[model samples]
Target: MSKDYRSFFGLSGPAFNKQIPAEAIYRYPHLEELHYYLAAAVADGAVAVVTGPVGAGKSTALRAFLTNLDPLRYVVIYVGYTSSDRALFREVAHGLGLSPSYLKGDLLNQLHGAIEHAWLGKQRSTLLVVDDAHLLADSLLTELRQMLNFQMDSATPLGLLLVGQPTLAARLKESQHEALSQRTLIRYTLAGLSRSETSEYGRAHMLAVDGDPDVFTAEAVDLAFQQAKGIPREIGNLCVYALIRAAWQEVRSVDRKVMGEVIQAQKGP
Candidate 1:
């Protein structure tokens, strides 16, 4: 292995089933309506949509929210993609561990049956969460919107949460899809971090990785926030690259020079 590789994988970043950082644990206010909608979806089954600009932390926030739910109480189906209605059904059914070879229509029926069985037998509610939902076709979305029909007159039983980029909101607003748009119980857009929030977020990512928060001077963080425009993933990528660049030169702290190099590398020719 290269010396660079030796240094890179040495740190203990939180992997799956590992710890959640305090900063990452707290879901920001803009997404709180989303949280409420998700809770209602699991309890009463509502259709919810969460949209945001690229790198705005929508996926991460959704993961954090879903992680907090009681596993025994909730059956969560996380679909990272659904290129078509058939694909969506297959993916959801697969996540729920249904037989993989069933027909698409049969899969849908089976999914509904499985959820109903759990709801009746154990009071376990199912939450269907689709992330990066923009790639989904209109027909597929229609099938998804119609799935709420599984509900009784009293409440929606098929809870749906769609997380996607801002384009998904535009798609919903098209004149052709009024019914789908109107059915959304709660809609949220994740905005980029605020100035103070950006600084604190950078510090937290550093602390999470056992790196020194003081490694980034306040000025460096300000520059990063300005350049990366307060996107959490960009903040993380930039900080990691900057720290690694610093470490390569055997520097204990990240200075302006190291940050500039990392930024330039990211913006390379």
Candidate 2:
């Protein structure tokens, strides 16, 4: 069995897990504002694009938004990763509770029909979230553009959200993708956490697992933020390492010296 860090630290459970509850995830004010924009985009049946560097909490924000949605009024489909157009359509079909076809065109028709029925016949909203969209081929991007062409007007029956790394925006700006880019309703780029946000984030996770908020000294946290560059994933890694290092040394609290040792250990042999 894997080592139980929580028990070792006299805590209730794993604190730094990626799959923590949405409510438990620290909601910096900026992230909450971004979530508001995304929620509005979903309600208006718009194609929204969210770009950010890896480990910037884009997926976490998406999960929080979906969790708060009204299930009776909206159908949410999340495809975390898709490499090809056929796979994308198949995922959508599966999300809609339909068996997908081998043919790409047939799959497209089936997905569109299901989306229309959900929006019109059932009076429900359809939200399709495609994560790691940056990896999709150009041809697939064209197909996605066509799917959103519900009517002559800009209004679409389905709300689409494309989430990926920062390079996704540049890909959309290519000449061949102008048509799709023009149809984007809103674009938001997620940035790393600010210093204050990082500090609060650290305390939040530690406290969530029943660890003392002051387990890490202020100077130690400052070093962590400097080393992690305010990225949540990196911060989590540094914190976990510090915890284990402190336990090994029989230290009650992590200080700058402990963090420095952790950083050096992470550097190399």
Candidate 3:
């Protein structure tokens, strides 16, 4: 029979699962700052850019912030994949529960009318979030900039949030994108956790699953921070893998030796 790690470790549920409740997520300082900037951007109907390294918890922070927003006051449209302007608009229309028009002009008009109605009629602000924006083509970027033009550029009923890797920030700095760059009112770069914060994050995940935090020794956590470089996702991955290895060996605690073995095994021959 396969070993039940959760049962063996006395955990009530799986640990390190990405689908964990938002309230159980560890609140890093950067997450708090991100929430503040996101809220400010939506309130001002402005544009914001959030960039970070891979596995730096950028999307996790974004999800947490969006979950806390007042649904009655704001309508959020999130698009994670888009290669062109049409695809982007179609995604937005779908998010609004409208059938996407086949023609570009019709689709654009449909999107505009939806945003207008949501703001003026329903009294709700529309916030559009595009993830992985670094891959956006220049033409698509230009289309996005044009979408912000409302009421002679005097009134902004829609807020735009572009989230991607650090390259997305660099892409915005080009002279060709100067117009769009100038419109960005808020920008924040997310960073990984500190060693202390890494330890807290590990313990928090354990506590979240109702597992004994001591399953990972302090030294093991210290080594994990060093190996994972304090990235929350990497830390969680390392801890979970280590736990599996410990369970296989019938060990109760993951110490420095067990952590080292797991790290070495991951490095391959």
User: What Cα-based lDDT does every candidate model obtain?
Assistant: 0.74, 0.85, 0.88
Candidate number with greatest lDDT: 3
- lDDT (10s digit) by residue, model 3, range 1-269: 53778877888888887877789889978888889888888999999999999999888888888999899988899998678788899999998889999999999888988888888888888899999999899889899989987763555789999999999999999999999999999989999999888877888889999998778888898889999888888888899999888888889999999999988988899
Estimate, for each residue in 1-269, the C-alpha lDDT of model 1 and write its tens digit: 22351254344563111245534443556556667766775675667888988888787778778877898878889887856777778777787788755577677778888877777777777888988888788887888877767655554446888889999999999977788888887788888887777777766665566645577777777778888897877876787777767767877666778888888888998
TM-score list, all predictions: 0.86, 0.94, 0.96
Candidate with the greatest TM-score versus the true structure: 3
**Candidate 1 Cα misplacement greater than 4 A, ranges:** 1-10, 14-37
Better of 2 and 3 by lDDT: 3
Per-residue CA lDDT of model 2 for 38-88, tens digit only, reads: 988988988899998988888888888899999888999998776777878
Q: Which scores higher on TM-score, 2 or 3?
A: 3
Model 3 ranges with Cα > 4 A deviation: 152-154
